[model samples]
Target: MKLYTLKTEIDAVPVADDFIAIEAPRPDCPDGGIVARVIYLSLDPYVGSRLRGRHMGEAPPKPMEGAIPGAIVGQVVKSRAAGVSEGDFVHAMEGGWQEFAAIPAGHFRKLDPKSAPLRAHIGVLGMPGLTAWAGITQLAKVMAGDVVLIDAAAGAVGGTAGQIARIKGASKAVGIAGGPEKCRLVTETYGFDACIDYKAEGWQAALKEALPEGASVFFENVSAEMAMTALSVSQTYVRGVLCGLADAYQSSGPAPHALNAGAIIGKRAQLRGLVVYDFYSRWDEYAAEAAAWIRDGKLAFAEDHADGLDQAPALFAKLMRGANVGKPIITVSEEQA
Candidate 1:
């Protein structure tokens, strides 16, 4: 077995120095447990935050120096668990950046290969999808005829949030992304009502023009600049969900962005921050709805995939810098591809 374990605790984009790929003992399947051959590893921005050991009232980072901790999609090669068998595909938050993992049965969710691609289990139908769903359906509570605005609109969570807002009957679904290509994918490919390219000049004015009635709901990602922009254009009684703080994730000091209390007071807006893991109990419900939308062609997703486990470091760095267009995933095994 092989695992990409964290070897350094530095404040920087995780390079090869930060992670070491080494041979390790394969985990044994205990009673009520399954030993899985990991197939897909999710590359995300939050992984950087984990390496930096930033605790915002959340659990501490993995204590072991050579351990993996992130979402993964894998296949069971050995199973002592009831209702699970050899060759069963599964998803788990504990899969880590490893070739094999021994997981308790309760910690694994069986994935249907027939529903979608194996990589998608760690992507749109995985944690990122659930994150978006929780922000919109649970926190922001977007409603029909409402104007919804989302930042990082081309990324995994943002892309899904925009599409779900439209499907749920929001009057307008606006997306903000870095480049024109991603902007086009958000609107033209994912069916967002409009997507603003933040890299372009005068994008703020473009956002204002796109949402003439003001934003009723804001599914925020990225930094405080984008969050405050959403707040500035908010309608009376608007709702905002603070999802990610990408701007501050790599900084050595403090988070560079701050919330504008004046805007919240003036708009009489409701803003709530959420950690998706808190909604883990409702994953089955979200998966059911998301699968239906995907099956019916009402929802769409894209993947920016790297070929192997060794590619995880560079791939994760690409994702942090917003170089990848969609969900950044690593294909850890050839069988899963």
Candidate 2:
């Protein structure tokens, strides 16, 4: 077996040699565990913060010893648990940066390959997709005629949120992304009504111009400054779902943008913080509906994939820097055994 371990404490964006690949003994399947050959590794922006012990109370991986944590899709090769059999395709959060993982029985979910592509189980039809669905439908309650706003619109969560809003009857879906290419993807590919390039001068004004009716719902995935800007132009009683802070993940200290309490009060906004874990119980419900949407051409997703486990570190670095165009994933092995 081969795996990548942390070389040292990551200070900012990981560079070359941050992760060292080495051989290890294949993990034994425990009494209530299953050993599966990893197929796809989902590399999210939060991994960078988690490596530095900056994420939601997660401990940093020990240097040279701890395996990097991530969500993975794999086919079970050995099962010691009841209700699971060999060759069962599953998705689990504990799958590390390794060729094979020993996953506990209760820690994994059986994935229906026929529902969508196996890779989609970790992207659009997976946790990121669930996050977008929970924020838009469950929390924000996006309704017909509502104008929706999303930042990091090229990302899995934001892109899916905007599209879901449209599916749920929102009149217009607008996105704020980093550059022109991402903006183009948001509007042209994801089918958003408009996309504003946050990297360009006067983008805030551009966002306001694009949403003439004012945003009725805002699915926020960037920083507090961007959130405040969105709230400033939002309609009265707007629904706001605060999701990710991509800009603050690699920061050395507290985020520079201070939250403006007045913005929430002035707009009488209904604000909610979204933690995808809270909606885990509803995965099946969301996945079923989202998969149907995909088949019907009502939903879309983009993936930025790397070919092997060795490319994980570089691909992850690209994600933390907001350079990835879509969900960052690593193809560890073939999907089929």
Q: How many clashes show up per model?
A: 0, 0
| Structural RMSD, model 1 | 2.0
What range of 10 consecutive residues in model 2 has the weakest lDDT sum?
A: 250-259
lDDT by residue for model 2 over 1-337, one digit each (tens)? 8988888888765654688987888999988889999999998877877888888999988887767989999999999989888999999988989999999868888889898889998899888899999999999999999999999999999999999999999999999998988998899889998999988999888888998889999988888888898998799999899998888885657777567888789889988999999998888889899999999999999999999999998888788778889899999999875
lDDT of predicted model 2: 0.89
Off by over 4 Å in 2: none
User: Residues 1-337, candidate 1, lDDT per residue (tens digit)?
Assistant: 7777767456665555567777789988878989989888888777777677663544434433355577888889999999898999989887888888889868989887887767777878899999999999888877788799999899899999988888888988999999989998898878888999989999999999998899999988887778889988778888999998876674556776788788779889898997998988888788878888998998899999888888887887777677789898888897543
Using all chains and alpha carbons, the TM-scores for the candidates as numbered come to: 0.94, 0.97
**Global CA lDDT of candidate 1, please?**
0.83
What TM-score does candidate 1 reach? Answer: 0.94
Show pairs that collide, candidate 1: none
